[model samples]
Target chain A: MTKVALTPLAQSLPASVPFVGPEAQERAQGFPFKARLGANESTFGPSPKAIAAMQKAASEVWMYGDPESHDLRQALAAHHQIAPENIMIGEGIDTLLGVLVRLYVTAGDAVVTSAGAYPTFNYHVAGFGGTLHTVPYKNDHEDPDALIAKAREVGAKLIYIANPDNPMGTWHNAARMQQMIDAVPAGCLLVLDEAYIELAPEGTAPAINTSADNVIRMRTFSKAHGMAGARVGYAIGAPDIIQGFNKVRNHFGMSRISQAGALAALRDDGWLGHIREEVSKSRERIIQIAAENGLQTLPSATNFVAIDCGRNGDFASRVLANLITAGVFVRMPFVAPQNRCIRISCGTAAQMDIFAAALPGALQAAHDNLG
Target chain B: MTKVALTPLAQSLPASVPFVGPEAQERAQGFPFKARLGANESTFGPSPKAIAAMQKAASEVWMYGDPESHDLRQALAAHHQIAPENIMIGEGIDTLLGVLVRLYVTAGDAVVTSAGAYPTFNYHVAGFGGTLHTVPYKNDHEDPDALIAKAREVGAKLIYIANPDNPMGTWHNAARMQQMIDAVPAGCLLVLDEAYIELAPEGTAPAINTSADNVIRMRTFSKAHGMAGARVGYAIGAPDIIQGFNKVRNHFGMSRISQAGALAALRDDGWLGHIREEVSKSRERIIQIAAENGLQTLPSATNFVAIDCGRNGDFASRVLANLITAGVFVRMPFVAPQNRCIRISCGTAAQMDIFAAALPGALQAAHDNLG
Candidate 1:
């Protein structure tokens, strides 16, 4: 066999994906999961107006999407009350995060994040050859103070925090978040991943600071807007920081149908309000079921709940396995303590009922096998 | 303004986009272009089945796309008579090219291409800190012998050639392509961009050699399938080369709707046949219109034609500017000789009529302004 030369940095990396998508799991198991509650997706779906817009634009796929994503960016700027120069649109938060790392991270540079906050972010840092310095979660939430201190100590170029975070579904209020933003060191860039911010309570998302050169807040249509598959996300930052993305981003990456769909979705404030109400109700139901089953539930500002398995990581893994076997898809954190809980996304009542039915048997199966 | 720290390479790079999209032009002009023929897009549109599939998936955009793009890859694998492991799908050929460059080109690595080839590819190489070595085109076509010679001379890690080349729209037969592939330096990778392969003649595509580790072939649904906005593209290469993409690619970058739509488009051979016929007809019409205006066209294997305006680079640029002013969108090459020709994409008869009506005026305007 012939050997093609690869970059030394690329060769040193492992061929691993950040997360095994639920679809891959289904293919391996030879059947699909009955209730898709693991990925923190909005089962309520995108607004009908967005769907209509995308379907209408389907026939016009012959043309390339505007590389600038002009109209969509303009609309986003108006909605946020900022100049379009302060926003940069991309395929998704994941894609934007990858671009962000490329702009700031060089080999051997340091980056700080919660130990298990978002594996995808860490994956990007590692992919760019950045050395990761992790701070453990404090009270099941990302420790902003620790992350800031560690970044300063290591002379890290980047720090990542997900407001209304994933896995544990815990969040800090706006004032606390503002403090963290202010405490970000001089040379380090704070990446505020607010993918779930739309679902968080009032006073959760800090005021948009377009002039803040040290912070870039990323928001997406995937969570509360219910268009994860559409792959639309934007970053709000200082003009210079936003313009830097132009040097590295795939300019024509946006899907034309997605641009149309996201624009329509963003304009429909009523649809967003409705999704919030539906997600709130679903969260309450999740709390009720976990309480009824003698499990403790974490408070959530996002569209998912983490149910305490009341045991070690091993017990939780066994329970998750049984749940998968029972056709319910739920995920857990990768670290200790947090791994003792299973995270479930808010779904329709029917889907939740399926999870509700499967959990008891799954728990029993876990106990019977382990004990 | 506070200076956020960027990597040294990034700091040294200018904030620039490879191409300014047509929408930006429209925004500046304060009106839409009457004839959209600049980007070489398939004005014939996507398969009806593809449009339908995307329409159906519009409602399902709440869920994230299968990060693996599993079903589409499986379908592509079957179509090409190759294992799924030999294929890697991405947002578009542009994204795949970016990843390929990241894998092969580290800082200061030598990469070779024709002087006026795809600018987007060059943009990616520069973005990754690759030192590009250019060889000028021979007789308005990509010179395989010259490219191979330059690669050897520079100890190039990667060589790029677009078969049925863009900007010029000329191609080489499969046997010549095979010679080029066989001549690639031992450690260097040959990147064959066949984004227009479906529209090329039957003998144009070289036989697939998945075991050949030195070459990676890229294709897109953008042209003949008419789904440029959907951003679906794939690369066929050796398993190890394909696997290397996993180390750095955004695994979940694909839009779920695009995956579904592309799979449907690939399965509908009759639709592809129809598109090819339409594109062929449109190409003939474009040739006729150029001839009526007393211009000479280069032999074109792709959907677009390059018309030599019987003048130098300055005159061709003036003609293009006049065309834009007359509500027609067209493009021209960037180098000296190639810049004497203007590139125009095929469009429907009504759009062609508009272009036809405007071409005489544009030419007169160019002559009047220059004389």
Candidate 2:
């Protein structure tokens, strides 16, 4: 049997998933995770109104989703005070990132991001055969100055920064973010990922400037909106950049039920406010729990907290492994120095109770194993 | 005022949607279509079981879908009597098509398809800058032999053919398909799109041979299963070819609710059987309606029927325009000769009654406008 030919780029790429999902780990361990917090998904769940909307739309799945996502985009435009042309809805922020990378990065073009930013973004760059340049995090935060300088030096086509960072949960205030946006070089696009913005404090995000030529901000329903499995996200950008996505995206990719759900979720500010308050409470609980356990918790503006293990990466990994074995699913940063901490997503009071009960025994197990 | 840099390929492409969805047309017309029979979606909708599953899953949408699509793939593998490795699920057949083209066809590479088969597939090819070669349909059917010959002649890396072809619902028997599969060039891959196969008769589909390196078969929940808005589709091929999708696909792209809906739909073969029977009845009714109106209907194994307008492309266009004005949404073929026909999807009896009532006026309007 002769083999079919693959493109040189495809042949050169490794077949891999950026992150192994918690479900896969559960399947391997032959048990379900008691608390599903490893992936930074909200345990608070989607708004009750969104759930009702999806349930109502479930019987109408015969019709294809509106390829333009017209209703959803119109509502989003109104929400952000921008023209509908400035928004593009897709399967998720991950899908949007993939399309954005394909639009801007050709083979051998330089792309810049923090050393340990979102892995899915890095995966897309590599898939498109773009050369990636990385700058290290400064004080556990994405260093915008270093990133901007690297992009200019390398003539990078795109630079990525998560406003309220993932894995580390650190954030930059609006003023600092506005300066970063201003510093973007003429030819470089800045991908401002604000997936966690809804959970952050007030003024965490810079004001929306839909006409800004070099900056595209991404937000999602997967965070405080509590619909990660709904797979709905949108990018806010200049009309030209937003329209560019149409040239390559799967036009009918959104689920009709997801559209209805997200619209409802967006409209119910009361539900969103409740979720924010709950998440904030959970965050404080996580911080207090860490302190009680003799660990240092990083200052966080996002839904999750990163607690310093006060040792090296290995110790953090050991602690995480022990936690998982003890029926608590948690994750950690991968890069050195930063990897001295393990990340834990905020969950319900009961889930936090479980985590609080498990951490001391897991730490003891790690210490005993090391000895 | 400086612009962000776009890749040369991006700069060269037009920012356009492949298909203007029926909903957009409705929005433009300032009213909903009285009958949405265009787009070939199942007006019958998904199974009740599937709807229930999706509604149930909606409350649990805070978690990301299993990136591996483990449970659904296992169910699909069991249903098809194949290994899980032979299957790769995606957002839809459209997304799978895009990924397949990216895997096999690079910029400037040759890809083959019927001239007016599936425009979305062609759109993806163009999006990736692949040089497309087209063969005319033989007697309104996708000619497999012609497609094979063109692939060999062009040294094409990929060839696409839809069985029980769209636009003109004509199909070839399994033996003919097997012969065509055998003719695939050694280095070329045959992307056999079997999206409509479930609506076709027995012996219409070529037997699955997952070990066959040159052919990959795609199936979807969008058509006969009536889950188009759910955006679930899968491809069955050699394990190696299936695995290659992981190198470039959006791994976490599938909506958790959609996965649940599709799984439930797949398990309810009884509902599928019921749909097939209903569609068969709808097809007969469509044929009778065409016969009463002095039109000839083509033989169709799929859910939709193509009725000959007994005139040229212009007359057919006028007929379709009148139908839309009469609030009956029907579509037609795009290429010459075949453009002499108008396509109508299988609808419920009430919708069929509306279409039957509207056809005579539409025909008269076309004739009166001609003078």
Candidate 3:
């Protein structure tokens, strides 16, 4: 084999995917997983209005999605009581993060994030050849203050925090989050990822403001809105910061029909309310189930329960494997201490019943495997 | 206002959007246009099977799309008679192009392309801080030899060539493309954007070779299969090259419903055949209309026509503006020689009739405006 002369940066990077999707696991196992709670997707469907809109526009799929995603953005602005100028929509918050990294962090630029936080953001940072500075979690929650300190120390261009974070379902109250925002270095942009905010406690979200160019709030319809399959998300910030995305973002990356569906989804708050109620109940049920199994579950403000598996990371690994073998797909934090737990997404009652029935057997199997 | 500092390269870039979508125009005009032919979308619609698949998957919009996009890739590989490893599915060709630019081209890296080939690609290169090495089109066709020579001279890292290309709808046959591919430098990756291949004349596409590491072919369901609104596209390349996309791609970027819709569209070739036939007829109608109007229409292999207004770009601009005012949404090429022509997409016979009715009035309106 001949050595192909790839770019120096490309050659330096390892071919790595952050998560092996459940679909890949199923393919390797040669069978489908019975339940999908790994990706923190909503089990409840998108709003009925969304479905109707998509169906109605299905035949019109030949046309490109409105590049501006005009209607959807208008609806989002109205929903949040913010100006449309402050909103920038993308394929997902994941794509938005990548674009922001490209905009602010070039090769070897210092960027800061929480350790054991969203690996996808870290992946984007690494992808852009940015020097990543990580601040570890404090008591299973992201230490936003430490993140700000790290960013300030490194003279970082970007500092990131997820308010209602994934993998742990722990969040900081907006008031607490604001202190960290105030501490962000003058030159750095604070990327406040609120992907799961809609399902989080009421105080978890900050008030939408157009005054600050250094802070951006990320939101998604994948959580309480139950449209993860639609691959839609947006960023809200000062008009200047929001407009900055236009320089590098894929203008036609959106699906026109999906935009229509999202607009329809946004218009129906009743459906969002119903799903939110269902999610809260599911979270309570999961906590109860974890307690019944003699496991401690973290206090969650989002839609998932992070159950402490009781032991080391090794023990939690066994539990996750056993659950996966049982066709139950769940995930966990990748860092130590937090890795002593497994995270389960809130799902339908029927799905939870399957979980309730399987937990005891899986726990025993995990113990046996560890031994 | 306190200045938020971005990277040096970012500060240098103007926050420019490549294209303003028709929807944006609609909002500016305070009403919707009568016909939607501006973006070169298939107005004929997608396969019934695709519509049905998307509708059926509407309830399952809670699940994120399969990150691997396995089933769709497998089906596409089968359709192309290539191995599954040859494919990398993405949000759309636009998104993939952005990633490709970032992966291969560095700051100040020379990347060669047509001066007016695809502004979206140019936008990506500029975003990545690459110095675009542009060659003007020769007689409305992308000059392969000139592009290759420039790439060799500049030590270009990437080269973009869209065959059966956009805007102008001109093409070089498979033989010509093969010659160009062989001439491509060893280190340079020829991005063969065969987006319009499905609608092109037979023998227009070069035979596929999954092992061709030097070239990557991009295809989309947007043009012929008519699923542009779903926002699914894929690249076919050697295994090693395809795997490189994994290091940075948004793994779950694909919309699950889009995968289903595109897969269904791929399987229904009969619908594609019908669309191709209709497109052929529409192209002929545009040519006839152009002849009647005393204008010259370029020969096209794709679903659009570039009509030479037999005058300067200013006259063509006036004509385009007049056409827009007549409620016929059409676009012209941005580059000078090409801008002497106004490009029109193949719409339904009804839409063509609208264009037909409007063209004479639009030309007169241009004269009136000039007066």
The lDDT leader among the candidates is: 2
Q: What are the DockQ scores of the candidates, in order?
A: 0.79, 0.85, 0.67
Candidate 3 stretches with Cα past 4 Å from truth are: A1-5, B1-3, B368-371
- lDDT tens digits, residues B1-371, model 3? 24567778778888878878887898899878898888888899899999999998877888888888889988988888999899999888988998888778777889999988898898888887788999999989999999999998998888999998888999999999998888888788899999999988899999987898779999998888888888888999999998888878886668888899999999998998899899999999999999889889999999999999887889999999888988999999989889999999998999999899999988887778777
Candidate 2 local lDDT, B1-371, one digit each (tens): 46877888888888887788899999899888999899889999899999999999999999998889999999999998999999999999999999999998888999999998899999999988899999998889999889999988998889999998998999999999999999999899999999999999999998899799999999999999999999999999999999999999998868999999999999999999999999999999999999999999999989899999999999999999999988999999999999999999999999999999999999999999999
lDDT of 1 by residue, A1-371 (tens): 24668899998999988878888899899898999998898999999999999999999999999999988989999999999999999999999999999999999999999887899998899889999999999899989999999988998889999998888889999999999999988888999999999899999998888888779999999999999999999999989999999999998869999999999999999999999999999999999988878899988999999999999899999989999988888899999879999999999999899999998988888899886
How far residue B272's Cα lies from its native spot in candidate 1, in Å, is 1.2
Q: Estimate each model's TM-score.
A: 0.99, 0.99, 0.97
Clashing pairs in 2: none
lDDT of 2 by residue, A1-371 (tens): 46778889999999998878898999999998888779999999999999999999999999998889999999999998999999999988999999999999989999999998899999999999999999999999999999999999999989999989998999999999999999999888999999999888899999999789989999999999999999999999999999999889998769999999999999999999998899889999999999999999998988899999999999999999999998899999999899999999999999999999999998898899898
Which candidate tops DockQ? 2
Ten-residue region with minimum lDDT total, candidate 2 chain B: B1-10
For lDDT, candidate 1 versus 2, the one ahead is: 2
Better of 2 and 3 by DockQ: 2
Residue B24, candidate 2: Cα error in Å is: 0.2
Indicate whether candidate 2 or candidate 3 has the larger lDDT: 2
Contacts from the true interface found in each model, as a fraction, amount to: 0.85, 0.88, 0.75
